[model samples]
Target: MSTPAALRALLDGRWSDLRERTRRQLGVVELPPHGLDRERHREHVLRQLRVLASAGHPSTGFPVRFGGGGDLGGSVVSFEMLGFGDLSLMVKSGVQWGLFGGAVQALGTERHHERYLREIIELDLLGCFAMTESGHGSDVQHLRTTATYDAAAGEFVVHTPEPSARKDYIGNAARDGQVAVVFAQLVTDGGEHGVHALVVPIREPDGSPCAGVSIEDCGEKAGLNGVDNGRLSFDNVRVPREALLDRYGHVAEDGTYSSPVDGANKRFFTMLGTLVRGRISVAGGALSAAKKALTIAVRHGETRRQFTRPGGGEEVPILDYLVHQRRLLPALATTYALHFAQEELVSTLHEVLGGESDVDDRRQRELESRAAGLKAVATWHTTRTIQECREACGGAGYLAENQLPQLKADTDVFTTFEGDNTVLLQLVAKGLLTGYRDHVGDLDALGMARFVATQFVGVVIERTAARPLIERLVGAVSGDDLHDRGWQLKLFEDREEHVLDGLVRRLRAAGDGDAFEVFNDAQDHVLRAARVHVERIVLEAFVAAIDRCPDTEAAELLERVCDLHVLSAIEADAAWFLGHGRLTPARAKSVTGAVNRLCKLLRPHAATLVEAFAVPTEWITAPIAQR
Candidate 1:
């Protein structure tokens, strides 16, 4: 089926020009053949980085004054599109331009930008983001690397006080990086300040380790070998006072630490929040990878004929089977949902980082929480969807030429990095609870009265399992239109609100108890709340995007895609809906049946859906898919 021009335009997302330019750029670039040799892969990625730099691709997000385009969202969208070709190259570019360069731009002042931004953007000086340590990946506040101020010399001496303090799994550290943005505790004569970023030279111009700096390659991993992962330990590494990325906090010449933000924890979190772009970019990249995997797998499913019917002259294509449709179509639908969610995420990121709007603290917190949750979900979705796509293609997918193995292997670490999914979910839950508390705290007399009334109703429902009554009333009014977008959204929203309400009550009841124990017991509940909230966000974003579509054939087709996403999500969580009496057992079964029906409806559009991603034929070079 030919892709509708309208749908094609929609699929280009917010950064249409940038996405098309990148797709064209990727189409023209010559990439190395897929391989297992880490060194070769590393060189291939480095070569691609040079190609990208020459093409001016890495400078999109940087300031135009610093030899960049200064298009934050466009840069990320372009980076995401690169995921279609080589994931290792995508990651390497992200490390160079997003993580390392972004840290400098977001955290540093004019002095640092003037000194390094242009060189970094041009790839003249490769760098590493030395934040994650052996002992602390997410807990930046307690890192053991210390930078002590030398008032006499106007320098800060950076040292890894213990083995665990060594920065580990630092991309570009093993091979290409000449400098690093090292995060360490800032100590002076007065007292120790919390974590601060300092630009320190790790390797000399000739690629040899600088004095007092030791580096070791992290060696082989499950995947992404093209990007050299390494560890660094500092033995009294000293950088000038001006080396500090002091956007948030700064040390005086007299060794007194001062920050616009009064508190240590606040300063640390605010600084770390600047890197939310990394998380958002990773989410977009993961979605792109999943789209590529689905494209290849679905195309193969369409062409690869399997078991012949009895006494039949020809074998039917595997995609004709219900099982195959079930495996690939729902994933395709989810890819759509993730795409829309990622678009919204990128927009929010642009607003925060693009200087287009005022980003207050609350907005920043919202953006961070949403980015963390979406990153977790999108990466986890990519990992699972790629695995399923691989299995759906059977033996053919296991081959490197098909690219599923590469996609699977590369995206596997996405969940662990940025932030661990589990920890991120907890962060989402914490944000939810904090927002809820603030809401209640700010209630006036009229609001408090309304809240009390709502709580009374909630208590009655919980005490009596009143869901059946409400279900009956709704069922009488609407019948079996549960697949309706509004119904689907209400179902998701209700579940999330209910779960949050219950979790909040439980936590409040545990007052004065062991806080850790209380949290430990409620971990599962908290995670469920986070998952439900993220699902709601994804659903709303998908529906909102669909609503914005112009009246065209593509819009009609997208409505079907949106329906599939809603039904599939509902079907996956049928047990929760049934348990809450939001869906009867019969209705729950109908949800699955509806999903199967939507799969059949979407089967014919599978090829078009994937093609709408506009991945170049060269990037998707699997033979079976090509056929």
Candidate 2:
């Protein structure tokens, strides 16, 4: 709810207004034209592409030199706001800006950037990120598409080569796209260079399929039907060898290939690391959608009368009921934490791109790890919150007119898209292992010796010891009457380390070629550890916000919100804490008690927090507006 002044200022600039006008234009000229029927929704998605092109969402992200506004931050901000009108429209806009234009800006060289970036940015050429294939949804390296170098003609021949190689579930593919940033294994006379992106023009200027490119529309989906998702297959599609976006690697004349990064595996991951940007944006997008649902649910609950109050003369607003408030308010607190985290993420992105700090190999991995962790946690949370928001609305929630079902359907794909949440969380766990490994080396002999002695001996020697002085410090500040933030944080940290150490030991024990097998087998436990780590991060963020609040009332409200977040997160993982001795029976009970108390305390601010998002009045006007 508390936005930095600079962020607020950016939100008020010309770009923001241009974005808002784009939304209004979309709402007026786009949605109505698309219609609601399944086929119509797909048509509408395709039609809205042209509409957005006219309104300039696609061109907003590119540099002015490339016929764009050249403001990435402003563009994403505007893209997020488009969700206020319609998510389908927002997604179509993303397929244009984030995928099509972004591919050129991030992966392509200056020549490629100049050649195609302008048309793509201008929406004169709609494009798709043709990366996900039928057989290799998450494992991009295993994708079957191939780009074989042809020395005679000096062009690379692209081919699906098989059914599994067909790029599946691509947006803007069925009806609108002329180009796609196709991900395929680039093979030359030298060797197979993992996956590389090639700009393939899949449609001609006359809106007809280009030579050797075939598309099949994926039929109606549960959500986002407004966006056409199609399967694409290419057969001996040829493009100049120069089409290879050679930022990381390149092919020389006479069929030679070279790269700055030596290791094949490292180069592969480095290329995919570009996708971390999308994952971070997805996390922010999830928060924006969750906040929207919470806004509607809270406002409706505040005004809609339910069972009788103590007086018994008339029914009460649903929000006054303890059950209703408890169900929705904690979700509101999470939305706040996610919002703050998103700001941090955007700042990191700008820092890396602006060269404020070196985004070297290690830093890139760290950024990817954090982005994945946040995306997994936030998307999973958003889906759950959407369900809770719908249930809180009771019958009206299911109605098509209210937009809850539509919102839920559209957002459902977020957990799996960008990257599968489970897969991503494991990446976070691997990052934690890497961090621990770094510490073990950094600590040297004496430090390592002390760590080993304390971990092993302290447990035995201090078995009967009472709570430490810090426990009292935690309880004093937390006021929860049982456990405290200090204990919860400590326990999460300890448990995370133990889990990672155990997994690593198992992995090492598995030995040779089965390393992947060992890693896959330990994935469940690793992901659980990652979840715990993310929860701790969110709790710390919540508490930090509360600690820094300058206003008395705001501070008190923030403290309650922090309590709500921590208690709810603990209750969600009660089994883990109980088994690991992090929480006693009484402390576990207090988690629920704290949840109830904080939920009640936060009920009044629920609507306020959502409104602070500043979504346009048209999308959500008041507590009672039906549309």
Instruction: Estimate the TM-score of every prediction.
Output: 0.93, 0.86
Write candidate 2's Cα lDDT for 253-308 as tens digits: 78898897677777787777765667777787777788778878987887798678
What is the alpha-carbon lDDT of model 1 when measured against the actual structure? Answer: 0.83
Query: Cα lDDT of model 2 overall?
Result: 0.71
* Residue-by-residue lDDT tens digits, candidate 1, 1-627: 244566778878678888888877786566568654989889878988898899888888999898888888888898898888788899989999999999999999899999999999888899999999999998877899999999999999999999999999999999999999999998999998889999999998788999999999999999889999999999998899999999888888998888887666667777887799989989989998998899899889989997899897789999999999999888888889888888888887787768845457776777888888899999999999999999999999999888898889889999989899999998787767655332222443233333433453331111012334334433545434865665776677689889988876666566556646767777898899898889888877776677677756777788888888888888888888888899898888887888889888988888888888877888878887895
Measured by lDDT, the strongest candidate is 1
